[model samples]
Target: MNSASSIQESRDEIVPSGPLIRLSLWVGDRNLPFWVLSIGMIVMLLWAGAFKMTKPGAEGIIPLVSNSPLISWQFKLLGPYMGSNMIGATEWTAALLFIVGYARPKAGLIGALITTIMFFITSTMLVSTPDATIAWKGFRYMNNLGLFLFKDVISLGVSLYFISYYGRRVMLDEARTDS
Candidate 1:
């Protein structure tokens, strides 16, 4: 066979087939992945916000909140339960925005921005919270609290993605109407 045909054959072999092709198509559609990410963020925010409103949850975050320069004032001003409740209310608002954003890209953009700020703040707890890391020999490893805070890094990335995607979508929609 000619080199061109051999290359084509190899390409065909590498390409997805059968059920894999269908799965690939589903992922490639963009909407599925976007909604999946949106749902995940919404669920997390709602659950976490609800938890924070509770006394136990408020107490649980005391150490992290106390150490945080950005939010420490809240604890002092509102005290533990009230301060945590305020944070929870913010989360609930963001979650509601995400739900509304499904129908409106502008709302989604706002939600994404809120989520970005929230995750960024939480991620910082890894550095600010004492005992977040454990020293073993020369290397530092995350403790349980550190591990918990580290998840915020992933959430931060997701929020950023939502921002970019929704931002572009909103811009494109506006451009279409303007033209």
Candidate 2:
């Protein structure tokens, strides 16, 4: 081959090879929207975390952090502020990792899974029902948390989308590599 052709071949050889790379190239790069969504979650969660730090006056509509009978006062036994602080930090970290696209796929899906589980616990405390949140429709106290639950559902859906798209590509790449 000519020198020019040889140089082109070497450059091509340096390019990434895998289903993830191919899928990324084919998607026309819409990951920016994912980053936005992920960051927005982080900001809100951090605000919640800060509220937890303040204690007795966390600024939020839901009084769940302060007055929910569902979450025991025993969380106070762990230095009085550990529960809410840890929860907030976890949320912030998950969302931050996702926004930066550092393990974006795993972050999205696993983050949602964690949140979904938290919400399920919250719903259970409120209604004493199983994981089926919709089953807790009658009590006024439980109903008050509806908005929070609804938003979590949305988060779950978006996270699922991230998992479905990027996660599948990652898996595909791994599978191809193994073969």
Candidate 3:
């Protein structure tokens, strides 16, 4: 082979086109992608909930929760420590349920629905959080914490998607079993 031909052959041999693409395609097609996303959400929920259970974390959020009309009653009823722990417990419950959903299709759909509601509440944090949209400090768009909460909207949407996806699979499986 000529030098140019040899170089072309070497280039062709060196390039890898299929592995990443194939892996992504496989993940997208299978339940693996949903599980992957669920794992991510689980981590976030577990971390946030566990952290909120800590004294400092609970104390830090006291004002924020206390200020919200929707949740303030809880704070008043439970006090800061118990109130934060309650929220943390709720988060942990969601995470645990989400994990179980991995093995059980119907349960997973329920988990996804729960996640959608949880994120929906967090998304509302944009409105309830006092410093969510700090502007004078040059915070715009997602420059502030409020803007950061916007991602929950996407998370909520993904949870809803999982519900539809898993719900259909579960229903189809049930129909097959019945038939």
The best candidate in terms of TM-score = 1
lDDT of 2 at 69: 58
- Using alpha carbons, what is the TM-score of model 3? 0.74
Off by over 4 Å in 1: 1-23
Shift of residue 113 alpha carbon in model 3, Å: 2.6
Clashing pairs in 1: none
TM-score of 2: 0.52
Model 1, residue 25: C-alpha shift (Å): 4.0
- Candidate 3 regions off by >4 Å? 1-24, 136-140
Quote the RMSD, in angstroms, for model 3: 10.0
lDDT of 1 by residue, 64-127 (tens): 9999987799999989999999999989998999898877889989989998998999889889
What digit string (tens of lDDT, one per residue) describes model 3 on residues 43-110? 98899899999999898777667667667788899888998999899888878877776666787787
- Each candidate structure's TM-score, on Cα atoms with residue i matched to residue i, is 0.84, 0.52, 0.74
Give one digit per residue, the lDDT tens place, for model 2 in 9-53. Answer: 885786768989877755534676666666676676666656666
Ranked candidates, highest TM-score first: 1, 3, 2
Query: lDDT of each prediction vs. the true structure?
Result: 0.90, 0.56, 0.78
Q: List the residue pairs that clash in candidate 2.
A: none
